[model samples]
Target: MKREMIEDALIQPTILLVEPDDKVRPSLMDNLHSWGYTLIVALSETDAMQRVQGKGEPFDLLLMNQVGHSVAELVAIGRDICQHAGLPPSIPVVVMAECYGDDLEGQDVQMGDYEYVAYLEDGQQLKELLYLLCPVP
Candidate 1:
């Protein structure tokens, strides 16, 4: 198949990205957008919860930054709200952080259905994680 055709055929996953760092958030947004994914970004946990609960198509994945709350806590809380709101709680959640307790990669430190990733990793890695979690139809 031609390159454009292959690209066009790939599904664009919708993501709810929760990041508090001003420096990192914009870069991540730009990267996701350029990679052809639809993005809904939130800078705070409150905003992230509100967005997740509000009316819209269910997000394909949740990409969050490790800030005030732990990855597991965020996923648990978000999934609960999602369930109450009649949303799918199975969608993968990825937490981006500068450091973690041990050497872990995607799905290695999964809590429920969430995964942990180093925030400093390049966009290609993040994109791969999204594809792994929400594969194209």
Candidate 2:
């Protein structure tokens, strides 16, 4: 089936993307939008929270690129935002990182209501993770 046709079959799920880098946003947005996800790009934690709170509907998933800020900071802000919005902790979150080895010590990212996806890994791994999170119709 065609890509557009498949995307049309599923509900238009909203995705909150938190990435500081401007260069990566366009490509990521294009790829996700093609799959029928409504992308709300935020360059910082504050922007992300504002968009999430101000929006009419809560995002189906939150995707964060942990580059500019510390993981702890990101997790804390993310959790707080979700809590403030009265959203359950079970909401799926995908965190992108360079290295998510055993060294990172923090309950925020390690044992949270979200899932972790290593950004340094290959594209196939990322694709699989995304498929697992949001299956195609």
Candidate 3:
């Protein structure tokens, strides 16, 4: 019998983690790996975009920490990258921040939006969010 090829995405979910905080990056990296995700880490948004623009493995989800850019900006960047990569423009984006500005306070999630900001308190919180977004096959 002939065997069909399997895509990496079908085997394992790939996550593109864009976190600029030196202190926070390590833990996120560890947790993603422990969760059995194929991760590509970028310390900055530009770097993250560059990786997406290249011929590297396509990312399943974008777990980004709002550094210098706003949450909406990052989502747009993800979409733009997806367009360039010839993929569907429906990338799921999770924005992690210790806290949002006054305007965004008390809002944990934006219902029906493709991208939402969440408080990154601990790995457990992240894991729960990941479960909803990325399901390993």
| Residue-level error in angstroms, candidate 1, position 125 | 2.4
14-127 per-residue lDDT for model 3 (tens digits): 898888889988987988988878898887767876776756668888888877776677667666666665566567788776555666554457433567677655567778
Best by the TM-score measure: 3
Candidate that scores best on lDDT:
3
Clashing pairs in 1: none
Candidate lDDT values, in order: 0.68, 0.68, 0.73
Where does candidate 2 clash, by residue pair?
none
Reference-based lDDT, residue 45, model 2 = 75
- Model 3's alpha-carbon lDDT is 0.73
What TM-score, over all chains together, does every model reach? Answer: 0.73, 0.72, 0.78
Ranking by lDDT: 3, 1, 2
What TM-score quantifies how close candidate 1 is to the native fold? 0.73
Off by over 4 Å in 3: 1-10, 101-108
